[model samples]
Target: MSNNKMSRPADALVEVADEHLDKVLHSMAGETAVAHDDQRTAVHALVAKRARVLVVQATGWGKSAVYWATTSAIRSLGGGPTLVVSPLLSLMRDQVKAAELAGLRSATINSANVGDWDTVMQNMESGDIDVLLVSPERLANPKFAQRIVPIIEHAGLIVIDEAHCISDWGFDFRPDYQRLSHILTASGATPVLATTATANKRVTADVAKQLGDSTLVLRGSLARSSLRLSVVPGLGPLERYAWVDEALGRIDGSGIIYVPTVADTERLSGFLASRGHRVVAYSGRLEAGERERVEDELRANQVKAVIATSALGMGYDKPDLSFCIHVGSPDSPVAYYQQVGRAGRAIERADAILLPAETDEDLWKFFATASIPDVDNIDTVLQTLKESGEPMSVPALEGITGIRRGRLESLLKIVAVEGAVERRDDGWRSTGTPYVYDEQKWAAIRTARAAEAELMRAYASGRGCLMEYLQRALDDSEPGPCGRCSVCTQELPLGGFDVSTESVNAAQVYLRGADVIIEPRKLWPKGVEDGRSGKIVGAGPGRALTYADSPGWRDVARVMSGPDLPLDAEIFDGVVSVLSRWRRQWQRPVAVVPMPSRRHRLMITDLATRIAKIGKLAIIDALEVTGPAPTDDAASLVKVQALVAGLHLKPGVTLPTDGPVLLVDDTYRSGWTMTIAAAILREAGVPAVLPLVVHQLP
Candidate 1:
């Protein structure tokens, strides 16, 4: 297709679209002179008829251009400002900039801009803004919802970016996105456009159904001609790290390394940096400003790669990102496609490599279950609110129902959607609306997820052409072998990267030194006794090697803690190395103490004695287990209660009056055991307690 033909607007809309296309090109610094015909069609569909449309196009296909141009065309027609329901802050930031470049003033209302909400609203009311971007979570905000109603009634267009999030079948389904259905109903005749790059047939149908009847669905080819897909499966953690270190030098340009967890991002980033790669870690945990800084660095090629979680997955605008390497397989092929789509956007032949690990399934299960709401917990929350007959704050609910604050908040949102509960200024109150548990629906979702997981496994194992397998998994119409992937051509350029023996050994050494920081629990959990529920005073920072970190200390720690397995010299040496590195940040302890464990007392004692010997400190038996340990899956309150009842000071053993103590344990989970132990020692006159654990559980 010629640029002239692609740029030519449809009849009757040619002049207006040409003007808007020029504005978009200007905003993009004249990167291209023509907009795709699909882009022009989407724009005209919105401006000419105020129609609802779904555009499922490949990444870098100018989906953003369609919306920005549509906003421009609508404003020229004296239409109200457009509203964009984006899924992430990163996406919103990019959209706001694009809107400005397209000659449309845009402002965002999200958690990061609480102070600027008033200013944004004022701009909207004064006709100073042409587009308003918001996160799905903002729709649930009572204040924002009330304030946005007037705007919604007159909105020129509503764009749901990453529209796959609205489908339960999507890998990244979010309940908050479901709130859009209500907004659509209230939006009346306002034009709506849903855009996404990764959606299977099921997700496409679901999203279209949500947008109402007669929604124009425009889906383009899912194939990315610029992407070269391959899989390097069965690599352990250390090997993967070494492989990345070696591969980074051979890759074409700056790129991203996607990990399955936050800890993996930090650990892998550190390992790569140690191997002389300029890299940084990016996760949801980072502050907004810090995330933006890292994004800018990647865009400018200041860093070779940013080891990131899915938090960096959507709408990160680095047009020339040359490669995307996954340390572990994503839960579904659709998600993997979406992430790999970030690369090869504006370049020819970007590498997309997947290094699947044995532990990927475990991570997938953890994440899948974490998002599904617990029926019992939801019912308990609703019943409590109903009994109260008034609004109650989250903290108060925590006290009444023993649910952790985070889980409680999630449950509240679920119930609020069901109309069983409502949020007010004070807190949350029940609406007396009876709610039925949707067991069948949840079961179907679980079944579908299991199938997706199997499909991911098949993809990693080279059951067929990599691209074709993914396309079929997404139910794309034109599924076929690309003839460029490793499987189809029997050539693997990604796996051809060489790793020296020295690099592999260095990676192993780095993995062995699995030191991790154990953050102290500052506030005691609610529903506990007042004496136990206040601020924990003498707790200090703690350290550990790894948290179930596979193919590393996790294996060693498991063997050492198992029945009849003794601590070895090599494991002990690694512990010493971790402590040596941690000592620089920690105050030198005056003494060392051990927390008694029912299953691993001997291992804990050995570790403590070894650490004390190395540090030249006294080994004190400060606390002993009074009863059995709590179950691994026990709730936070249950764990605390069991620890409080089971742990006690050793007979005739008094802690020092004014110096820090090294409190050692075999492993750390909920930290209740360490918390209670530290409290006991502190009450006995110890000034500060620092926790050291061999392994930490995620």
Candidate 2:
């Protein structure tokens, strides 16, 4: 077995016999053509420069091949071992399997060590390993430092997979990744290589800055042309289950359903199984053996779909998957995009579905509640690790306590927190393995959330479009009205309608939680006078009316009877404020629109209903809810009214009301226009007033 190690072949390994390359590519499963144009360019760029490279490549672009090729090239030239720092243990295992399959000698040091840690250390020290694969946390370990660090220093190339972790602001933050700079600096003479699938401009710069002497190689198009994006809104529990059934029924290849919680994953898996679909569930709590069995099923194509949380996609690459659906909204767009990316990996047509629920506001609020873990939690986590007699690595700390990286650094700052955990020069250790999962830390998070009660309240109840807000935040470019989003395709009105004559007189107060209370005057002290009493009244359900007085008030109208008519702008503003509040308060779905007048309330309603049905709620604030007056029997009446009031409808499209209708108009006066509009709406065979208006004067 001593001679079993495959020596590095000379001459850049000569494409591994072409047949071998074909085998490697085909192993990716179903993806026969490796037409990754960007990846090819990036690899060539690195090879030509003979410089250390930081390659930011997207998933399924064959990033693994780039490293394998580069390593083979260096090896042929008598280069030393290539040290690869990967994220997951499973990835290390996969690398080993792939290397063995490729006729190479590779070894990995991780949790599933076949021998004791000391034996593994001796093997690496003896230089028996050709390619060494270690976890990010392993690189920071004192034990690893004492023995393997010297071996790694002797290596000529260092490869970091999923290098985006180094960019603190990126979606997958790991505190151990922050230490890569130190590790690379200490590696003495080795040139470094980096890779990842997701990163923004800021994160990209940070990766380069942190990895000294690095040449950046970015490959592949961010666009997933093969996948179709669809959103189903307003679906109840039964509808959600049916939707999943339908989506799965439509696809032939394997599929995945990503839910936000472990409980949901289990529930959905059971429900689907009851329906006779070969389904499985995977989550963090599952035993490793059980988890692997399910994964094997997915890889073997024995299961039609796997209902899981975010943990399912890492390490396992399945190209035949038709699509991945989000049973509920993810906490952020970064996460949503990442999960959705798993589908269509082989560049085939796939679909991503978003189903929102009424409790969505609560979930969104939960995100806001856990303020980046306070300085104390960091301190506690670090101090606990240090106090523990065992010399633990970063992953050990994280694995034991489940503390994420973004909050790790800050938590480490408190006086109670210890600075760094290191092995004694000699390596063996004593005091204690001080880690404890602090219940108080969770308590503090909850307290912080409670303090911001009003803000959360607004978020849960406000409405417009959830996807729009998520897209603007996640993608650098604007994805205006994705025609298929819950907001764009909604068929019912969720916002209360406004029927006012004096175009601007009827104020539209967008609301979350269905109720709001406002003090009449800003300067009034508590108990000085009874607070201004009013109802958030409007034509649609979520939309309402509120009062406000501001200078340069446009199109002013004095109220002769009803509470002082606030401008529609004021009402819209109030709605936004409430929604923002609800997001922090109850974690409800909320969106705010600036102009509540003239906009079609029905469109907003339909969008909200759809979102609620799908188990996702969003607070979207838009200015264009108004439509124009119809001129002919076939014109879009909603568009006609929207145009008359100069409402901001998404550009270049009219409401999809079927059939021509008679036109009707009236000056913005008390209920005059609504009365006329309603009469005409009935005559035109329009089933109901499209849910969009500032107010319908009673």
Best by TM-score: 1
lDDT of 2 by residue, 1-698 (tens): 01112232422333332333444455533356563555454444433333456665545767777666555544544566677888875567667776665445687776556465676666656655557888766666655666666766667567877776665455565656556545654543455677776665556677777765455546434555555565566565445565675556556688789987775676567666765789998897887567768877887889999899877755567776776777767655555666777888775566766776654566667665443454455455556665675655443454344454334433442211222433443332324434344567557535533433333232122244434443433333544544543345553221212222221221111111223222111121112122312231222112222212111121221331333233344444443454444334332323222223333344334433433344343333323333454332211222223333543334442221342221111112233233333333333343333122222221
Off by over 4 Å in 1: 1-37, 404-406, 550-554, 584-587, 613-616, 627-629, 633-635
Going through the candidates in order, what is the number of backbone clashes in each?
3, 112
lDDT of 1 by residue, 1-698 (tens): 11233333455455676678668866775866687777777777776666789999989888998888877876775778888999888888888777777777899998898899999998998889999998888887787788888888777778899999888778888766776555755554788899999998889999888888888899988889899999886676778888889999888799999998888898888888888999999999998889889999999999999999999989999999999999989988889999999999988889999998978888668756666778888878888888889999898887677677677877777666667788787899889999888988788878888888888889999989999988887788899989999888887765585567788788877767756778998877666753577787656888876676645664764564578444788777777888889888877899999888777888888888878887889999978888777776555776777788888898898678667999988778788889989988988889899888777887
lDDT of each: 0.82, 0.50
Distance from true location, Cα of 366 in model 2, Å:
3.6
**Roughly what TM-score does model 1 have, to 2 decimal places?**
0.93
